[model samples]
Target: MAYEGKGVWCVGEVRHGDLSPSLFELITAGRIIADARSETLTAVLIGKGVAAKADEVAARGADKILVLEHDALDQLVDEAHTGALTAAAGTEKPRTLLFSASVYGRSVAPRVAVALGGAVASDASALTVTDGKLTLERSAFGSAVISTVAVNAADGPEVVTTAPMAFERSGTSETKAEVTQAAVDPASWTQNTEFVSFSADESKEIDLGGAEKIVSGGRGLGNADNFSLIRDLAKSLGAAVGASRAVVDSGWIPYKHQVGLTGRQVRPRLYVACGISGQIQHLAGMKSSDVIVAINTDADCPMMKLATYSVKGDLTQIIPAIVSEIDKVRGSSNGS
Candidate 1:
């Protein structure tokens, strides 16, 4: 298969006036495909005031950097991002475009693909280039199986949105990259969407993706009110709250708190599962945690088997006790 055009592009995301941590993971993924095809790797930073961060991306070994800046990009407007990316891709003509399967990426990848007459695959897990053919792997049926798909470069470029944490960020050498600023005029960019007031969940001020510790709940919690036990335990340990898909689907919590194959992939230092049966789908997301504690009545559940410490009992009874013990330790330290 003759690869079309040249270079592999990673569409990076920015947050809080700097680059997002997920950009490093995309770099790791892009590098693999770039090395396999013996092509140069470029990182595209598109946002307001993201020029300063291009140097850091270049330092991380990107061969080139394209910074598309516009005032309209101050917030994540799908049309504005889609237009900026489409213009950038039109000029650079990268064969493969990679994006993190995040809120921003999910909205932009397909739109860019449509504008460029390319193929797109979302929620992609693994990537491999075989004989210059780019192949992306997507999990099927709750991650119980994986499907491999090859994109035909002859038709157009391949635009891919990868699952967060699906690719690990490894160490990279400091290398310089040629940075180019593409000022996409606002007039050219489309904007049918209006900016609304942004309301954040105060309870989730601690980001689940970056949280060191997480306490997750499942349907076994019995009712939505029981989720407070999970929240209390998480608060006691100064950890973020997570939930299984079953509970999130049941409206016990928001989708942002879901940790599973089809949800957020997290690698916390400590992961405590309460009243969770630990399906394979749930394990697929947090199995990489350094420590796993499973609390369930049935000790033979998959989560219990995978946990570093398994407690066979009722989580309603167990969670409060753990929280109480932590409180006692904290109190003793405070008194000391």
Candidate 2:
């Protein structure tokens, strides 16, 4: 195939040897943008065994999968991957480039854009492509405001890394697509990093990144010991544990478990806030959830006002009761 301007190019990612679902989700959203601009959606699949990965890329409605396979490209050496992807961008010259706002993508996408002398919009919640220009929306300034950015670089394609939980996959396997293989090389690079074995926290092995249900607590939980109620409720509901700014600041919870402007953003199917007063900064991260349930003794709190389901009661009394009810239900079901 000739080097031509296509619709959009997404640098596909694989975590722990599996393709990230966020890639497919972006492709689903990209298709609509590309169609609106009358173009085809192409994807760059980089890593070992690129050919084997092409089938799934095609299945996900990618019009073209540019496969770059080489041992040097096995693990992301930032330098090599950036060079290879920048070369692919030159060859494909896509109108737009999409990437996940994942740690890996966030690290590399900006580098690639810089190498190409292109502008980038990082952590976008929504994207629109029209007349070869892209508009991206993202939360900004401690989530107190939303900013819409437009990128029209004279040098290269518009690059975008989407925020977590902004879009979902839409296309089926029937979408027409074709796959092609390509090779890219780096000019020069130095590899000095040594691989080291590190273990995950057994307690937090279940990541909250893509959780479907989330329950959070705030300073209203009273003290560090009282935070256990939040964890118990989350476990009973098979949900992830989160904390508000006040809770995190009070050292009741770690910063990683925090959900707010400076912390993680979650758009779960169900969000339950216990003892949290919905500050604007805190609400920015989770207000987009499909269902919001707030439990607070203060019935007039901001969170209670915004909650789809509000329960005016003491969390100390409510949480144990909920746990007991769940235990009883499970016990009865198991004939215990």
Candidate 3:
């Protein structure tokens, strides 16, 4: 395997005012691949005056910073951003393209790959490079087994979208590298959608990823009212609250808090499931958790079978008792 002159490019993510956290996370992970291949890790920051953010990326171990500065790129319109990224990728000719599996990255990676005549693996849990080939591991069959795939592409870069929580952030020394600025014309872009407004909830929400403790409730929570107990327990433990697909579909909780095959995939340190049946689909989303605790009435439930700890009882009574215990612990911590 004659492997030389390989470049790894990570798509820079930006929100309204500053760089996104996930972009840093990706850079941290991309550095590993870059070091493994003995190649440079470049970051593409696309937006007007985005070049100024190169210093921040440099702090995160980017060897080269490619800034696509354009007035039209100021706003993250999928079409414009994708076009600019595709154009930049064409010019750079990286061997591998890494992107965060975020809202923006999900929208852009596939389109850019298509434009570059490359192959894309989305939402991959693991990525490895060997012998000049990239192998992507992704969950399949309701998250029971992962299918490892080697993307075969004859031209352009191989695109890979990594789950936000798939890999821990790389701890590498920063490298001061050259910054290249490319301004793409928006008129040349094929715009199918227009930006209407960017008004969204500005409040910071708890990120399920990287959460040290998580408390999730399933359909067995009984009613929407019973979720309060779960919430109480989560608040006491300073943990994020999650719900199974059934509970979300039943409108017991918002879809954002759902954890299942079709919902947000989580890899928390401690996952506490109350009343969740532990279906394979549900299991797929959380099986990677470091520790699992199930509180269900049925002893034979699939989740209880795989749990590190199980408590069989009525959740209506059990959840409240757990919440009380957590509250007591918090009170002691606060000198109450």
Candidate 4:
């Protein structure tokens, strides 16, 4: 079987007429695969007025930028975006396709894969090309185990959705690629679905998914009112606030702050678990963090076992001390 399209392609996500941060990360990952295979790294941008953002993707290591602009794609209707992507894939026939593991990418990638007769790997934390075969590593069994899946190049293009923060954004390239406009007829494609208005849920000041540092509370915080300590520590650290399912269930925090298998998956650079017992369910969501610090009264708790640093004490006493120390350090630094 002969493959027509000869490179790795990334499906970029655009929001508010700009490229999403995850798109840069995907470009980095795609560059790796493209380099391994000695192929071009292309990015497919689908949205109205998205052509202007092609230089951003090109600078971030996209060798070729394919723009699929349409009025229907402006608001991200699953069907419309999927149709445009499917059309692009059929024309390009890239060796591998990459998407962000965001809500939009997760929703559209699988559909495009099915339409193009390809296999899809979702929520991949790591991607590589070994012996010219694409491999994806992702959490499985409620994130208790990591499973690696390999896609054969002999098969069509491999579709992959990468988890946020799994890879750093690619550095700017001195060389740039010219953006090409791809033709996509929305009318020819079945318009079974129509996009309506979108309403964002009440979100935290910091987005948990993309947060580099997080300070999470749990049932061990003792009460809803005591959660202020968690908030204070998070604020001091300039980190997002997270909560275990137990805390959310107990109404100590909103569901948006919940971090677990049933909640949002986070891959922060630093994770501070205060008053959390470190249940497997909660660990499932954050075990991918680069560094974990656990403060719990029980030394034998699971969080302590998994943490890089474990502080054994009462959180109420420990957290305040941490805050004071941070403030003192900042004050001294500012005074100087």
Where's the lowest-lDDT run of ten residues in candidate 3? 1-10
TM-score-based ranking: 4, 3, 2, 1
The count of backbone overlaps in candidate 3 is 0
Tens digits of per-residue lDDT, candidate 3, 1-336, equal: 321226888887777667765666677677667887888888888887777788777666778888888878878799999888877666667878888887777888888888887888887777777885678888778776789999876765678888776776645565576888875867766998887787765535466754768899988988899898888878877888899999898888789888878887888878999999998888988998889999999999999999999999999888778878877887899994
Query: Model 1 over residues 1-336: C-alpha lDDT tens digits?
Result: 443568888888886485777777788899889999899998889888899887677777678889998778877889988988888777878998999888888888988888888888887768888898888888766555688988775666898988766677645666688999886977876679987867756663467875779999998899999999998998898899999999999999999999988888787889999988988889888887889999999988899898999999987888889989999999999999
User: Each candidate: what lDDT?
Assistant: 0.84, 0.79, 0.81, 0.86
lDDT of 4 at 97: 86
* Candidate 3: residue 196 lDDT (0-100): 79
- Candidate of highest TM-score: 4
Each candidate: RMSD: 3.9, 3.7, 3.3, 2.0
**Clash statistics: count for each candidate:** 0, 0, 0, 0
lDDT of 4 by residue, 111-160 (tens): 88888777888888888888887788988897888898887645466888
Higher-ranked by TM-score: 1 or 3: 3
- lDDT string, candidate 2, 72-96, tens digits: 7777667777777887777667767
Q: Report the poorest 10 consecutive residues by lDDT, candidate 2.
A: 188-197
List candidate 2 stretches off by more than 4 Å: 1-4, 48-56, 175-177, 184-201, 323-336
**What TM-score number comes out for model 1?**
0.82
**Which is better, 2 or 3, measured by TM-score?**
3
Compute the lDDT of residue 156 as modeled in candidate 1: 69
Query: Candidate 2 overall Cα lDDT vs. reference?
Result: 0.79
Residue pairs in candidate 2 whose N, alpha carbon or C atoms collide under 3 angstroms: none
